[model samples]
Target: MFPITADWMSFVIVALATLFLIGELLVSTKGIFSILGLGFITIYFASFLDPGMFFVMIIIYFFGLILMIIDGKILNDGTLAVIGLVCMFVSVGFTAPNMVAGLYAVIGVFIGGISSFAFLKVFKKRQMWTKITLFDQLTEEAGYSSINQSYKELVGKRGITTTDMRPIGTVMIGDEEYSAITQGKWVAKDTEVEVMDVDGTKILVKDSEKLQKKSAD
Candidate 1:
């Protein structure tokens, strides 16, 4: 015969909630367990009747939230485990008519508050997470090869500007139009200008003397 006040059901719920929290942490599947854990705790808390018990539950919930922010993974898991143990002990050890209800209420509060906070933190942080890419490493290697190549060899190199660069524009050097800084002052249209210097990707050039003299007028 189960005590009218204390039942195995409370212990079972707490145990299950703890497991859910653990699962959520281990799997890193967002805040699924966090939500469920809080829901279980809320239900348990509601079943109990003491004003003082609710207050205690609120305190526990607040503590868990604080721990969650600073401690994150460790606190999230630890709080659930501790609360689960407490709930199990209270449910099984005491048969007072109001004991189970009070304990359940506390458990609910602990789970709801802690889990909600944990879930929100995880959700917010997830957005900023970035995956490591092989291209990042390759960029350095590629840049080295690109830098070592001769720009002077491109003196006569020709390319179209991808963007209008006022007096300067992109000139297709081989497959890439480098940042062509024109020396001609103003080389409108796709007028041809020889590569004067290929200091890095900046291609410096001037309009042919004929064009320059005509523009000077």
Candidate 2:
């Protein structure tokens, strides 16, 4: 099993190495997965390359792993993650002695990457990923309600526009200022307007004078 030589063995070795390596990042395994991954990858590369070449390939593989971590923790985007997979595949492929073995190794990297997610279900996930990706629903019990909830209470309140309302401007209601929109009508600054409705955070308003004239009709 050490220093795998058969074409099919390339697939098995590469897959196991990738699975354990990525699993190490997804959940806490106390370094067992890391040791296993390093052992298998070292064996696969040592099987066909000189010592110098082996070191170069190993460095390339780990560089790919670093890119994946940076993408997840900082970018919160998948771009670097995809590039990392390509890097791992290339390292394994280039180390293989033949085209068939290279092809097998590349496929193994893809399969192992997808299977690593299974660790998330079986073990407690690493806490580092939670800060950027997971979020709790905001509720009153959490010491606060959603921001939109407070905006809902402002409906029917009268205020004066602090800026010209070319359908969108700022208004002062009592002592507080709010961004508001009119019904596609332009109103000069200092004109009185009433909050006609509130949809989520959006405040819809109409000129108070126009509203009273319509009520009189």
Angstrom error at residue 77, model 2: 3.5
TM-score of 1: 0.31
Cα lDDT for residue 30, candidate 2: 87
lDDT of candidate 1 over 1-217, digit per residue (tens): 2222455466555545554554454345667777875565455544553566755653454354444433444344566656544543443233223665446534643553345445444443332222311224435555654443666577755554555557767766567666778765766655655666677556786555554577799
lDDT for position 88 in model 1: 39
Question: For model 2, how many clashes?
Answer: 0
Which 10 residues in a row give candidate 1 its minimum summed lDDT? 126-135
Q: After superposition, how far is residue 13 of candidate 1 from its true place, in Å?
A: 1.2
The segments of candidate 1 whose C-alpha lies over 4 angstroms from its true place after superposition are: 1-6, 50-52, 61-217
Q: Please state the error at residue 215 of candidate 2 in Å.
A: 4.7
For candidate 1, the per-residue lDDT at 166 reads 78
